[model samples]
Target chain A: MGLIAREIEAAGLPTVSMTSAWDITEAVAPPRAVYFHAPLGHQTGPAGEPDTQRDLVARALEAGVSIEQPGEIRALDLRFPDATGWEATAYTPEAIPMSPDGKPNRGAPREPRA
Target chain B: MARPADAVPYIERTRALYARQAPYRWVVHDLEHEPPPWTPIRSSLASSRVALISSGGVHREDQEPFHFRNDVSHREIPADTPASRLRVSHFGYDIRDAARDPGCVLPLRALRELVDRRVLGAIAGPALSFMGGIYSARLVRDDLAPRLRDLVLRQQADLAYLVPA
Candidate 1:
């Protein structure tokens, strides 16, 4: 996530990535980026949690607008009202293999379709 | 500016958790004491295609699941990764149905909607996905970046929306 942001930002496009994992976000630290305290797998807020989703998305869009220099990292101040802690929940990780047209042949090999 | 106390418990907890996990020490420590933001540039997506990547560690059946053996740490999947399908790999939210919808988690639908609304110039084909959980710092920096570079370039993606899972 961070690396892709770095490449995009390096390519001269301002980029901001929303990451739940501070380690990854801090390291990748694109020119403009934000970190969320949400768990991994749901950085854009709790999946279908509409209001939470709206707020996070807004923050991400805002980061792109507000950033002023290179390698900046901001923490988006949004959270799920019901989350007990970062450790209190579990989510199933799913695969999104690119369709025949979507695969990036030069990058990681497409995982075989199930 | 401030939010209600209940609205940010996760923020407070995440700070405490980061203290305990201390996972970000390396990156935080290495960054210039005060790095700044860069903006005001044109949307790179203006003339070129764009892509979106996620780290929720979501994947499909035939695709090998990210190494979940440790129960505590996992591998970093890069942006260009291709899964036969998608899933919701986290343990927090209960939006299972939305997870399957792909639009809910990956939001290609939202981007398309943005294009329809003219919020964006266009949609980039070849959205990307990553495993989202790896714990090792060396691998993420050294390993993942190169792969992401290749992915975006191949897609000819001028911009990318990286929504961490």
Candidate 2:
């Protein structure tokens, strides 16, 4: 996403990226970004929370205009509700159970490789 | 920016996880340049035509789902797409929450509400979406980025809001 932002910005369109991954954002360095500590799939906030989602959308646009420096990432103070220890669980292989053959058993079915 | 004391070192963790789980190493591109590309916002949110872009694998029910691995192609989701009509197909993160409420990832409903309240001027129809966590930075830079840039340019969007889930 940050790569897309850079390309769009280079083409004369301003972009503001909202990211949950701080390390990836730092590495990719989009022109402007608003960081949220929310979980990966819930970057806009929790599901069933319209108010929080609206607030986040508004805040991201505000950051689009207010951010002055290129590659500047303004970390929003907003926190996902009751989201404790999410970082520990996110993107970790250990969370998935291992099969008898020693293969990680990702319970959910994934799309077959094309 | 001040991160929380307990912020996870995702880079290191992901690197290690990929080593254990996948056949290949996972690496994020570390840009060494001092400054990234920049384009100033020419209009206020009340007047600018904003476009939404998400790396959350969001697509309309009628559109094709993104490939599970190394797929850099994107989908164009209409701005007025309802929450129920949206779907997610990505492997990098849990999709349960997003499946229940697409707004948590795509936020088309929230963006429309903003436009209705005059917080935004208009939504550039046909918002863009693609799967993130691709292994090749070259594909993203050379293929996906250029294609998405062209689409956003065609929309004449004054600015874009990107959400990476």
Q: What are the TM-scores, per candidate, against the unseen true structure?
A: 0.61, 0.89
Tell me the deviation in Å of residue B90 in model 2: 0.7
On lDDT, the leading prediction is 2
- Tens digits of per-residue lDDT for model 1, A1-114: 565566555655455677555544555466666666654445565655544554456556656546665665666766545455534422211222221223322322232322
DockQ of each: 0.18, 0.52
lDDT digits (tens) for residues B47-164 of candidate 2: 9898888998888788888765678988988887788788888767777778778898898898899999999999987878998877777788788889999999999888888988
Question: Which candidate gets the maximum TM-score versus the true structure?
Answer: 2
Tens digits of per-residue lDDT for model 2, A1-114: 877888899899999999877777877788898888887788898999998999988987796579997877788878888656777776776442332223545774343322
- TM-score for the first chain in candidate 1 comes to 0.65
Cα lDDT of candidate 1 equals 0.50
Residue A96 CA error for candidate 1 (Å)?
21
lDDT (C-alpha) at residue A48 in model 1: 51
